[model samples]
Target: MNTLLKRQLLRGLLLAACLPGVAMAASIQALNYSSREVDYIAVENPGNTNSGGGGDSIRPYGQGGSICCFSVPEKWHADLKVVVVYQLSPDPTFHRETVSVPQYPDGKSGDIWLIVYEDGSVGAVVSLYGPSRPEWPGKIKGYPVPTKEYRDERRKEKIKREKAVLHSMENALDGDVSDLTPVELMRLKGAIEYSKKLINILEENDK
Candidate 1:
């Protein structure tokens, strides 16, 4: 080949070789270890369309399903950073921060995880494994721990549900059942009894 053509071919080959290191699109997921729900969380590299993924309303101590199409380099770089934007429960404001992406444990990229910590801090990790795996490389290992505030909120919700059930059952029993079948009346009475027992148990526990 001519000198110009040879150089052109070499340049194309080099570009191809470097493409994987430059950027590769991958899915992103959020794991919430915080007591409060994650109203929304997004991860992106500024000015780069290839790197953007987000999910909405990840419950406290819950894992969000993966979102598509975010760039993750095949190799980690010291200067690599991503902008994480998130909102938590009881806070109307959105929090933004630029966090460095931790290196992959084995130096190979897979899915990207955005972890929401108890203190509302955000962290980034690139790994082929989920947090459930022993090989996962997150700073906080294991599943989320529910906070006291979360536990209380859950208890209140449960009580509310139980109260609603009790109310409905009571109303059904009070209504005219002259035309009702025997089986239906018996079933309703059984449900009322169970509801009473459950509510009593819950009330005793609260005390």
Candidate 2:
């Protein structure tokens, strides 16, 4: 081949070799906000803000419970949007809104949420409802929603965590309360109470 032909061929080969790596290097920008999944809460606007019901009517399928999805306020409907946050990725002190763990049953959404907590820990919430097997934009309509299967997995994991915590607290209770400092005793008591509450919730769901 002539000099120019050889140069062109070599360039083409190099470009082909780098194509796969370049593709792999690109990160998925789907805005998949999650926890360990992080404890992400789906705030209507932000980690805090208007997530709590401010009189907005039930969303798309409000009949099935808000977990299925909720609609944006009418004021913002013309340009309404549901931002699927991935994380705080910033200082919590500067934030005005907060992400709280939603109450049982209602909190589940197969979709991923990104938010920060008071302590600055990133929180992610997986749908414990939505759909059983969702396919993307098709499965979701006005707003993003998770599938039932995803929620089931999260529910199980939550139950496991709660049980583990309960076990530890129960074991601690077996020890002498006299040895614990006042503060330590107070925290232990609080944890025991919280753990039991969580256990009760999970058990109730099972029934």
> Best candidate, lDDT-wise?
1
Give the count of colliding residue pairs in each prediction: 0, 24
lDDT of every predicted structure (CA atoms): 0.77, 0.40
What TM-score do all the candidates reach, one by one?
A: 0.76, 0.34
- Candidate 2, residue 154: Cα displacement in angstroms equals 0.5
Count of backbone collisions within predicted model 2: 24
Q: Summarize candidate 2's per-residue lDDT along 108-202 as a digit string, tens digits.
A: 22332333322434332333343233432222223334445556676888899888878888888887778899999899889899888877888
Residue 106 C-alpha lDDT in model 2: 39
Expressed as tens digits, the lDDT of each residue in 138-160 for candidate 1 is 99887677877777778778988
For candidate 2, the 10 contiguous residues with the lowest summed lDDT are: 22-31
For model 2, the local distance difference test gives: 0.40
